[model samples]
Structures are given as C-alpha cells and as structure tokens.
Target chain A: MRRHTFTRFAEALPAAVLAACSGPQSPLDAGSDEAAGIAILSWVMFAAAGLILVAVLALAAAAARAPAEQPRWATREGWVVAAGLVFPIVMLSALLAWGLSITGGGGGASSPPAAFRIAVAGEQWWWRVTYLGPDGSALFSTANELRLPIGQRVEVDLTSADVIHSFWVPGLAGKLDMIPGHVNTLPLVAGRAGTWRGQCAEYCGGAHALMAFTVTALPAPDFERWMAAQAAPAAEPDNAEGRRGRALFLASGCGACHAVRGTPASGTIGPDLTHVGGRPTIGAGLLPTQRGTLAAWIVDPGHLKPEVRMPPFPVFRGEDLRALAAWLESLR
Target chain B: MRRTLVILGLLVALGAVGALLFAWSGLYNVAASVPHWPPTRWLIEFGLENSVETHARGIEVPPLDDPALVHAGLGHYEGACQPCHGAPGQPPNPLVRRMLPEPPYLPGQELRWSPAQLFWIVRHGLKYTGMPAWVAEHRDDEIWAMVAALLRLPELDDAGYRRLLASGARMPAGESARLLAAVGPAGEALVACARCHGLTGAGGGAGAFPALAGQSREYLMASLKAYALGTRASGFMQPVAGALDDEQMGRLADHYAAMPTPPVRPAPNAATERGRAIAERGLPERGIPACVTCHGGNALARNRLFPRLDGQHAFYLAQQLRLFAVGTRGGTAFAELMQATTHGLDEAEIRAVAAYYAARGRPR
Candidate 1:
C-alpha cells in the first residue's frame, strides 16, 4: 500500500521538475541529497505504522479465538485488561525514548550550533521572516519562504501575526505553531540536498490553504556566496530604462505596500523587494516569471490576485511596461 | 436506579425540547440590521475580545530596535489605511464609512492597544467588523511595525504625517533619480537609500518594519505596481500611489532591486538554499515557474510597476504570495497576475518559494 502511493508521488515530482527549468541554475540534483534523510524518516514512520497494523490484526485474531468461552467476569478478561494497560505503557515509553533520541534529546549531544537565526512571524495568511546579523543585530527582513544551506543549523524564531499558524515541512521536521505575540523556536536542518515542501499547519484564514513555502539546500560555499550577496548595499541602475523603471516604481506608488532597499518607498505593508531581479519566482513561486504575466498582473493586479494589499498600475503596457520590466530584470 | 435514570432522561429531554423550541419559535434574531440587546452584544464582544487576549497572551515580543517603525508605516497609512481609518491628513472613505461596524479612526479610538495587540488586530482581523486577517502568514512583522508606527498617531498632524511619507522630501542632492541617471556622471545621483533601508538594507522601521536589505527584485517591482494599481489590494496603497508617477516608481524599484541583501540571516539550520536554487532558477520537475521570467529575466524589457527585490524582507514576500495564491493578496492594480500565477501552486510550492526568496542575495 505504501509503495503504491510513494511511487506515484515520486514519479509526479520528476515530471514537474523537468517542466520548470527555465533558468540558469536549478536545485533538482541538490534536492535529492537534502531530502534523503527526511524521506527516510517518513518511510520509517510509515513502516512502523504498517507493523503496528499487522500486530493489531494478529492480536485481534487471537482474542477472537480465545474469548469464545469467557464469561462476563472471567479471569481471562482480567488478563486482557492488564495486558492492555501494561503493554501499551511499555511500548509507548520505548517509542517516546526513541523519538526523543531522533530529535536530539538527552545529555549525550547538544543541538547543532546555530549558523543563523531567523525570526518568522506568522500573519493571517503570509509569513514574516527577519534575518539576524552575525552580531545578533536585526538585519534582513522579508516575507514568505525561508532559505538556508543544506548542512547549517538554523534557529527559527516563530511568532504569529494574528491567529495560530503552524509551520511544518513534511520532509524536514514536524509542525510548530506561530501564536500571536509569543515566539516559538524550531530547530531545523536540511540533511542533504534538495527542496523540501511546507505549509501553514494551523488554520489561519482565507489564505491559509494557499500559505506554502520551500526550503532549498545548497553547498556550503554557495550558501556563503548567497549570504554575501544578501548583505550587499543597494545598487543603482546605470541605464535609462532602469532609471525610468525606478521612477515608475515610486510614482506608481509601489512604495505604499512594499519596501525597496535605499529608496523613499519605505513602506512595509507588503513584501520587501530590494532585489526583485535576483529571485526566480514571484507570488511565492505560484506564477511563472514572465513579462506578459508580470504585465498582466500590473495592468490589473486584482484580476490576478484577489484581496491582496497592493493595488494595480493602470498606466502600464507596451513600451512603458516593457521598460519597467527591463529595468527590474537588469537589476541583478 | 430506575427513578434516577428516568429523571436524568427527563432533564436531557427538556434540554432538547428547549433548544428545538428556541429554533422553531425564532427566539434568536439573526438579523444584522437590528443591534443585539446590550447584554448579548456585550457578552459576544467580551467573549471575542477576551478569547483573543487570552490566547495571544503567551506571545513573546522581541524588543523593538528602530524608532522609525511608525515613520515608515506612514506611507502605508496614508496610502491604504487612511481610507478606512481616518487619520491626521485624511478622512474615512464614504464607502468604508458604510461598513456595518465602520472602522474607527485609529489615531483617536483604536490606539488603545499595544503594538502587539494592534498587530494581532490587523493580522488576525475581527470576526464581524469587516476586518480581514492579514493576507498572508508570517507578515506580522510588517503589521506590527505598522502598529508601532501608529503609536505616534496621536502626536502627528497632517504635515507631520505627510513628512513621514517622504512627501516633498527629495533624495540627497547629486543623487541620480533613475538607474541610468545614477550611473556615470551620476555621482550626484547616488542618493543613499540607507537613510531609510539602512546601510545594509536592513530596514530602519522598528519591530514591524520590513527589511529591504535582502529581498527578491522581481517580486519587489511587481509589488510596487500591485500597490499603485490597487491590484495587490491593500486598503492603504491607492492614496499613496495617487500622488506618485511611474518614473519615480521605477527608480525606487531599481534602487532597491540593486541593493545587496542583508548578510546576517536566521540560524542556517534551515534547508533554505535548496529553496534558493528554486528562486534563482526553477523546479522544472515540479512545474514550478522561474522567478526571473517576470521579475528579472530577459523576457521583460524593463521595469514597470514592479519594485526591485534585491533587499526586500522575506517574511513579507512569502506572506504576499500566500495572499495572492489564496485570493487574499492586496495592493494595487496588478495583483490579478499574482492570482493567476498562484492559483495552481500547492502549499509546498509557496513555502519553498518563500524560503528560496528569503535566503536570496542581490542578483548578479
């Protein structure tokens, strides 16, 4: 039963991966390595469940065979009750110990050192991620998706924007709730290389079903390079289109809902877009990053994403929109 | 034993009968038109208010760093919020005024909450007051930052509010206003966005402020237009965009898109780089689209309403996309594209994308 569903899920993934390769680099190869441990853990759990099912069936059969001659208060009935109480306790205690060990319990070992700390605040529908600088200073901040290297240990400081939002990545770790005001901590490590899937485990609201994210694992050096890039100061464009695009960004009022690095558009009602060109996806990887799609979204944002905070730019299309897209793309 | 059982049965039957009679006789008025009796209204209000307070009690609040959280929140306040909650420089929208429990003027009556409480109100939203929960999860930082910013409302005047918006404020002299303008001979055009985003692009807004130092550029640019066009769908963005033009928008997007992402990050135990690769490239096998196609790829000729994402906040990005995918994304005119793009993705994709984008750096 497990094999059937597992194979089906696995097969569909590769197909989808092949279809998404429109960029210079991808994490396909790296994904397998990262997901190995997580996959193993999941499979192991499934196997354990299967074993339990078999055992229960066997026990049921035995009970049926022996209970035919029992009276209401027979000595055999007392034995069954005692077995139920003692056996479950013993088994559960062992399982608990095993589970704790896997999660890095006891004095035998300490948690992996935290390479970095991210404070994630769960809002009604979105996620707020704040990066901590080496010195514990507040550094980079943004929303949705949390990125990390394959081997590093990260301390995720989780909180909620409103109601309860549970953060969970089926392949990496268990679920943790982000409650309003209070911060919860979750320790996560990507075992190998690969992208792991996750979602809001708690019911937050209308957008709860759509709240999702990916954890990408990469080589150490590559991750380091990424960190350096994330730390660099804002760069100004050196071309006319870029200049026009910059102006358009502010005047068009993109600043009201978003924040860009080093600009008058310092509003924080939405995502921080200090490096739009650097990313490969938008709407958290929901839409293909394309000029037409971007243009369509801009011309009428409400049509693309309903009930969102940022408004539409009615005065975009053709050259103007093209110029804007060009300038934004050239940023990287 | 029989008599006791009979009595118990009779009590149960009576309870059931009472409930059925209540239902059949229309004992409770469900009409929104008439206000509930004072006792019922108070009971409900108390239940909702207290429940939220009790449940939210355990939240751990990090100390706020910047004093400008509200200062930055001003732009959003003027642009979207003022329409619903009357502010120093503006009055409530006539349409919003008609809402059943018309949103109050935050500066006057709604300022009683702590920043966290305000954040909860904004992020989680009220039950029947037409208040909507935050469009996305993990966006509490932005909302809380706004709440922190709102703390100053009582002391602000129309002019003060406008000033906070950078209204009439020009970038440092000699700074180039546009990317092309900022280059060569643009020594003067190099205005430091750090004044707001800070030296490292880590935003200067207090606790709830967004970090612009390290965000995805494409999402940034797109977000800007979404606000301007009222597509991203924020109640606060329209008026903000009302005063600005396209050129300024593009320039801002460019500057931020070019900034380096922050160096300090959350403890790196998270498997974000794998997600990063997806953001930098695409998960072809999963049918996940590349971020650059619209945000930074060659497919587009230039920037439009989209803001730059070089140093944006990760929490904010993840939250917005979730909003879009679930039909809750709000801002300006171009939010529709986000909806279309997000419609097919499952929760896994959104999380992956958020993590990938969160760990990204300035694009090359």
Candidate 2:
C-alpha cells in the first residue's frame, strides 16, 4: 500500500512541476528574446549548482569511508585555495559578466531601437495603458489589456498614479518599478505572436493581488487595424435594445467618469471604453469579457473585486442590465 | 430571624398580586378625556424632557439670522403648523383644544426651549403625543429653517406674520386652494405646494421650495412617486405627495410641467464665474463631471428623466447638493450617479455650481 502511494505521488509530482514551469506567466516558458536569455541563465546556474553538489557529496563520502591518515595533497591549504577561492571567484565573475550582457540594463539585448512607445500608468487597482504617437503625445488610452506588434521592440514608459508598483511580465522581460512622479522605461521585444500575462509585482494597497493585465502580441497588420479602430469613435448600435442601453448609459451619467469615443462621455476618471468590448477580459483581468460578466460588474463590482473604486448600480434591472451589457459587448 | 423573613416575603408577594389584579380588572382609563394622575403626568414629562435634552445635545446649530430662511419657515408654518399651533393674536382652532395633550400655541413658546431642543422635538416628535415627526428625517436644512422662524415667533403679531408670508409670496392654505381653483382639479391638489412654491410654481425668491415649472412631466412624475415611496428625502414634499392618489399625482405633474418658466433675474455673485466654469468644463482631475452633461447645457436631445436646472433657485440647489455630498439626499434611481459625481466636491464648489445654475436663463 505504501509503495503504491509513493508511485502515484512520484507520477504526479513531475507533471505538476512541468505544468508550473511552462505557463504564459512563467519565466522558464520564454516567449521573448530577453526572457529566453533569462531562462538560459537560470538553467546554466541550476546545472552548475547540481554538479557542485554531486561533487561535494562524493568527496564527503570518500573522506568518511577512507582511513584517518589522509594524503599530503588532500590535506594541503593550496587545495583549499584552488577549490574554494579561485574556483568561486572565476565562476562568479563569468556568470555576472554573462548575465549583464544578456539582460542589458534596459533589456531587449540585441533588438533595434523601439518602433513605438507605450505609456502604462499603474492606478490603484488597474493599469491605464496609453498608445503614444510619434511625437510622444497620447494617441488613445485603454485599460487592463496591452497589445503590440510581434518582432518589434516596444519602449514602455511605466509610472504610477499613486504608489509604487512593480510591472512584471515573466514571459517578456523582467520586473521594473513604476514610481510616482517618475517614469521608468522598459524595452521589450516579443519573439512570437501570443498572449502573455502580467501582474503587479509590488504590494499595493487594497485589491493589489487582483491588479493583473494581459499582453497580446499581434501580427503587424492586425495591430495596426486595432490601433485605428481604437482611435476612432465607438461603433453605433445596430439594434433598438442597444440604442436604449446607450440612452440609459448617457442619462445615468456613466459618461461622467468613463469616456466612450465619439460620444459625449469625455470624462477621464475611469478607463476608456472605446475598444473595451474587443478586450479578452475586464476588471483588470479578473473576469472574462462576456455579457454576463459585464452586467455583473456594472451592477456590483465590489462584490467580485473587494475595495474596487467603482460604485455598484442597483438601478440596472433584468432587461436594462442585459441591454446595457449587450450594447457594450457589441462595441467591438 | 427566619420566621420574621418568611412573613415579610409572604406580604410582598400578596402586595404584587393585589396590584396586578387591580390593574388587569379593566379599571385603568385610557380615554383621552380622562387626565393622567399627577405623578404619572410628571413622570412622562420628565422622560420626554430628558430624552430631548440628551439627543439634542450634539446638534450643531447653523446661523439662522437670514431673513430668507425665516421667510421660508413662515410659509411652511402657515400651511402645516398654524391650525394646530396658532400665530400671535390668533388662537388655535377651538376643536384642537378638545384633544388630550393638545398641541401648544406658538407665539411665545419659542422662549422655553433652545433652538436645538426645538429642532429635535420637531424632527422626532414626542411618542404617544399628538405631535408627529417631520415627513423626511434626512432634511435637516428644512428643519433648521423651521427653527429659524420659530425663534422669531415671539416678536411677530398676526399682522407681522401675514405680512412676512406675503413678502415671501405665500398665502394661507385655504386661500391658496381657493385662488388656484382656476387651475382645475390638479391645482386644487397643489394647495399645500402652492403655500411655499408660488401659484405659477415659481419658488420662494431666496430659494425655499424648488421651482417645478417647465420641468419635464416624466421627471416631475418620477420625483412625486419617489417622494411618496420615501425614496426621495424631503420633509416638505413627502407628506404632500403621500396624501395624493396616483391620478391626482399625474394631474399635478402635468399641471406643473406645462406651467411656463417665469422670467429669472440673474443673481451673479462672485462665485458665478467659477460656477460657470465647473458647469461647463468640470474639474476632471478630481473625477467631478461637468454638471451640464447630465443637467442640460446644450441643444442636444437629453433624456426627460434628467431635471431642468436652468432657472432653479440657488439656495434649493445648494441645499440639495450638500445633501448629496453627505450621502443623504435620496432621489430617483439616477440619483446614485450624482452621489458619486458630487462626493468629492468641496462646499465652495457646490455653492458656485448652484449660483451658476440659478443665474442661468432657460436655454433657447
């Protein structure tokens, strides 16, 4: 019975370890050139440490089993100097130099200059991402989700609206602190077109654990199309229910804190909803983007994400809430 | 000692049983015509006085010297108070005197209690007494106005009382209904409203009642329903609205909605410019939305549910905003949106916004 349990545990352990080491948010499962270098460095250090451990164990076993009278060379201080001092110094210096070369101070070690700039401000519990124009003026802003073209080096200017927050996407580059009143640039290059997860690495106040986002590396043409669509006004509702929802949204003063392009909702207190429907998730990636989730969020955001700033709207009822969610979903 | 203790215990038990039997034998008279025993009356009065003093202790009094406030209070007093608590030289109705613990006459009664005690008694009426609490508990501003007028009651004779109400464009309750009879059945229902809000629905000039004229029928109807349902907090409007049936409420809403907006005199104070800026641009950094977006500042078609604020009284607007800021001004479902938008505004900003709207003319 004990052997059977042990066998089962052994079988499950590797699978779990492998699974944990290869997610969209795992540094070992690299998707960018910079992250690949980090993965390689991690593996090299692991292998070197394992080898040293084995050598030490073997030497200790041999010493313990052997006679009390040891050889002159084994007992000499010169052996200690060669084994501990010289070996460690050379090995550490090599590792440090290699590491510095791979992860250049700004990362994107071998990539060309960044093609475009993206500014991401860490809010209380959400990421406010803005796509900047050539002259560095803000083109448009979105929240929670970020997208850039694959194979292009993108310079991301990270800052905070309130407190210090660390922006980290394990599959991309490395963690960087987003400090208030100061901007830190993180250069990232995505080698493959795929989605990656990013999280707040530092402890912010309430709802900090839920402050997460996503990075989608799109193809060049698709990325351009998305940018243009996001820049334009929201698409007009195609149905009567959608129109009613739009009227309610404006009349209920949702426009007071949120801006929908091409509408009277020019307020910038909350996230922009121009392309919110197209996003994969909402509420700082806390929920999947769907009609049901959107309606749930609108009616009771604090219920799902504690200490969230958005107030619940008890006013939206069955049909009204459904229509509003459906209309927002249709904005894509 | 044991024998003596037994006797005393038996005697106490016998006394308790005798008292219970005397009380339960339908012997105590609860009729209003029957006066209470002197000791019982003293005990009840003692409890009432202590309770009021304890509760009214922490209530901070606002400055009540404003004549406009006194004027507004007089208007309400004539409608809701005068019949029960008579003005100077005019005795209360003879029939009111027949009730047990009759309501007091008000000419010189203000001298007995401090303003805070008066406010407390008016806000939360004495239990088992004929006095009733204010219709809306959240409307402290209106209650303070009553206190302001109550403070002046001792100095006003019958002529002074009538003249003060007249200067505020208010009349007695019966006179209001008789004169508004030409407005049809809806006007008849608005007698109480007309006492404070004028005949054409123009508010008291210094901002007593809200201007209801030219408001959308939908908005007015919703507000009336909210007041009756106790969802909207207003001591003045709730009782008046609660007394009406749905049909009467509809008629009244239609009547008020159709009344032409009276010409407004622009009262541009120093804050008007700042108020105009906030109404138009808003302090976006603080997440305060421009007031005009929801309250109407453009020619664009807006939802009728949003009330017209173009010619609303500055005092009324400022009071409502203060209520919203403190999270007490309950209104229609849309009011929650204003709670969030106005949560961060300072008092100065609120007054400025009100002044801007008050000085604004009806949009063309």
Candidate 3:
C-alpha cells in the first residue's frame, strides 16, 4: 500500500509542475481561439514524438536481448527499407499536412470583419498604444497596457520607434515583430474576458527585462466605456492641494517630456498622462497604481526601473509631493 | 632527490638576488609620457579587476533607490569628480585627458560593474590609478549615492544631465526675489551664502550641509561667532565666517532665520512614528523629557537659544543628535541640557526623534 501511494505521488508530481507552469501569462492556457489551436497542435506533436520514442526504445531493447544469431526477418536490408526511409517519409508527410492546415492563411474567411484596430509602437523600453477610429485618425493613446473587446477580431498594427521589438501575448496569439519603419499586422480575438500579460521578447536595451504590459479583455460595452473615458482630458483639481500640485507639475519642468491634454504640458517625449490614474500599473508595470507608488515613481523612476529616461525629482518635498500624487490619482 | 633540492634552493636565491639588483639598477622607465607595454598593462588591469570583484563580493548594498541620493550625488560629482571624469555633456579638462591611464568617460561605464563593485571601487580606489578614495571614509551613504547616479548616467543626454545638475541649486521664485533685493552693498558677500545654503536656506548640498532656514536668530548669531572665534573647527566654514564683520554676520544671520522654512518629507519607515511618539510623549522610563517641552511643537513660545528643528533635513538632525549623545556638539547656554537629555537615549530613539522633528512644520 505504501509503495502504491509513493508511486501515485510520483505520477502526480509532473502534473503539479505542469499546472504551476500555466499562469495567466502562459501560452498553453489558451484563452483565445488562435492560442487554443496552437496549443492543440503542440499536444498532437508531443504525443506523436512520444510514440516514436517508445518504438525506438523497444527496438533497441529487442536488439540488445537478441542471441548470437540474427533472425532471417531482421535482416539489415529489411531494417533499412522500413525504419530508415519509408517510416520517416510517411510520418514527416503527415506532420507537414497537419501543420499547414492548422496555420494556413485566410483561415478566418467565415469570421466577421475586425471590429476595431490598434497601432502599437515599440520604443526602447515601453509600448505606445493608439486606438484608431474609422477614418484612420487616432481616437486615444495609452501606454504599457492594451485593452480589447472579447470575441471581437482586432487588428494590431505593430511598428517600432527606435529598435526592433517583438509583441508577444502568449495567452492570446503568437509573437509578431515590430520592425522599424515598417508596420506588421496581427489579428487577435480573445474568447474570454480576463487579464493577460504581454512582454517584449526582443533584447532591446538596458531595461528590456522590465518591458512588459497587460492586456485586459472585457465585454464589448465595458470596453467601449473604457475607451470613451480614455478619450477625454484629465479632470481639473477639485481642492487647493491639487491646484498647488498642478502648478508644481508645470513649474517643476515635468512638461518638457510628458503630455497632459488641456494643459500646457504637450511634450511628446514620454507617456501620455491624460487618463493615467485609471491604469492599474505605472512605470511599465513595475509598480501597482497607488498614491505612495505614484509619488515614489515621480521622485525616482530610474531607481524603480533602472536606466529609465525620467530624471529623479529631489526638489519636491512634504506637501508638494503629496499634492502631486493627489492630482495624478484624481485624473480618472 | 638531494641534488634536485639543492638546485631548486639555488634557483630561488638567485631569483631574489636578480630582483633586488633590478630594483637598484634604476634601468626601468618610469616616465608618464611612456606607455606601459601590453603585457604590463594587462597584468595591472587583471589584478585590479580581480581585487575589486573579490572585495565587493560580500558587500550588502543599502537601499540606493532614493531620488534624494541621486540628486546629492550629482552635485558632488559636478563639484569634485567632474574635473577628472567627464560628465554626460561636459568633457573633462584637457590636462586630465593627458594623465597616464586616462580616466574613462563614465556615461556608459556603469553597465560593466555591479552596484557592490562600484561601491568598492569608490570606497577603496585602485593603486597606480588616479582614482582616489572617498575623502570622508565614514560616509558610505554618500558613496552609494554616487553609485546610484552613475547607474543612471547612460539614460541621460547632455541636456538632461545639465538639467539634473541645475535642479540641485534651484530656489523658489519668491525666496530668490527677496534674497536678490536684500543684497544692497554686500552683493558678492551675500550672494556667497546662497551658494551652499540656498536662497531659501533649504541647503543645496543635501545632507552634506545643514539647512539654515527656521533656525532661531540667536542660535545663528552665536554659531557664526563661534566659527569666527575659532571655537568651531570646520575648515570649510571657518574661513568664510571669519571674513565677515559683526554687522555683516548679524545681518546674514537675521536674514536666514527670518526666511520661511523649507519642507522636509519624512522617510517611509517605522522610525518616523517612533520618532513622533518620543518627540511628543517623553520616554519617562528612560528619564528623557518630551522634546516639545523646549523645542516648541504647537503654539508654545520657545527660547531663542534653543534652535528650531522644524523642517530640518533628517540626516542633519540625526547627525546632530548623535553628536549630542556623545557630548561633542557644543552650542549656547542650554547645550548641556541637550547633552543630558540625549545621554539616556539609544541610537534608534535619537534617530526617531530627529526624523519626527525634521518632518514637523512651524505654524504660520
């Protein structure tokens, strides 16, 4: 009984490890149709490979156990005809056909046209996401996070600002390279409403390891609401402290690199802060969106994410720091 | 075996004699104009790399993520290190470039060393290299600050570096206007004060210098006198303070004391609360009086000799408190009281109370 229990535990160990491997970010979890198809194909290939391994092992065992004399049926010529040439030809042909069918182009002919489109520009260490309206004009701009409507085909136009970066959201679709001066298109449809993590797979520069974002798939109406809110300018400060914060924000030279709509801070060098308060994370997902974190990030972004372009603001102290944080948090 | 041993011993003795003779001969070139041979250069560099790596292996780095550290490091770098090592936009002096084994440009050099390695190099500079050890060895915190700034050097361009260096000396508009107007005839003399102690008395050197804002007028005057009379032994302050006459000293003291106190943000630590507790309610068990009884917390009238601690830098405050605990920092009449009060407090208690006072603000 003890031996049986031990054997059962040993069998379950691999399953436990496999379970731990498939997190919200794992491609094998397959939250979308494209990812599911890829996962299914991967499983099929793994099983076929396992079968091939078992057959080869059995043949090797048989050969090892054979007596001094070889059987007539197991001649060298016969082994070459069956194992060396014919078996490989048949197995390879089947795998090629199966792969072509699964990943064949124009497979989405029966699906409806894409509901919306997003253009993602990859920079040194951050993502610049822009939602495109029907007329090809930008509807809204956000950074480090992408939002999508569930069960809707969305076309993502990928490009680069500085160097080549790959946008890979494993739970949704395959990786696509964002090449400089050229736009690559990727169509994705998430079947469920959930939050998935995406990462820049390319080795960009100093902060490449920290270049990650989140993709939140919501119901159509909820996505619409989020888009509408993101389109508007940041709300005005409602209190004296917030007003002081706004003044400090402009006077402290923060306007040189960042943009805030309806304000004089129109520099396009850094991320847009129009609706920054609504985002769940800041500093390229390095920290959670909270008052203390926001203040800390403003004080020293390079410390949190080393080699970031933003300089530390040691001049801000006491009520000034608090006010700045309050004004940013009130943007939503 | 006996023959082989004898041969080996003779060889060792001959080698030592040859080395001593070579040293005495003075035939080896030691001119700065002459570069080391490739092998010799490689040996020195190899030794330096291994030494730094081994020494840095066990160094536990403190939290260098603070922006304050970076800002202070930039100021120190511009003042001292920039002459030898070039900044992002500014090049090193031409004379320094001609030095043997020229100092490498530091903009992208931080990528090669880990934080601990950088700390070790800064703390204990390499031999035969012009890199000198930190002047103040006890200030490891300042070394870490420079390391933090070095790590961020790659991200900044010329304009960005200039901006960062400029940010350290900036004063509020109102304070600047007021100070500029007050410099009637002693223009250069008055302006010199703003160089280290900012126009608003906020202190440009971070914790390297003390903030003069919100200090009691009497304390300022008395301290200046102590510096002038050679009672205070600061090499940096003594010369400047000694140069001033009675009228100039009094006017400067009154001017800084009257200025609005700059705000000092409290560090996010458990010590802040513990500090506030001790500052408000005295640790009676330890025979310490509540700090507010004399320092003036709410609206209480304070003694002029007792310096105002509100809005002072936590680092400066902690340093002073420690000095008082050790009975070294002397002041006006009530200095003994501070020494006695601090004698019963531990390091943590002193730090907490200092932080509490540093974060406190004077009533309008």
Which lDDT values do the candidates have, in the order given? 0.60, 0.83, 0.75
Q: Please state the interface RMSD for every predicted structure, separated by commas.
A: 12.6, 2.7, 22.4
Q: Please write out the lDDT profile of model 1 over residues B44-83, one tens digit for every residue.
A: 8788778678766767665544554565566566545677
DockQ values, each candidate: 0.04, 0.40, 0.00
- Give the per-residue Cα lDDT of candidate 3 at B137: 52
| lDDT, candidate 2, at B164 | 73
TM-score of chain A of each: 0.75, 0.89, 0.90
**Candidate 3 — which pairs collide?**
B275-B352
DockQ of 1: 0.04
Candidate 2 residues A109-178, lDDT tens each?
5457889999999988999999999999999999998898999989999998878999999999889999
Task: Tell me, by DockQ, which candidate is best.
Answer: 2
Q: Write the residue-wise lDDT of candidate 1 on A53-115 in tens digits.
A: 656765655555675676454456676776678877887798777666555541134655788
**Model 1 TM:** 0.42
Q: Highest lDDT, which number?
A: 2
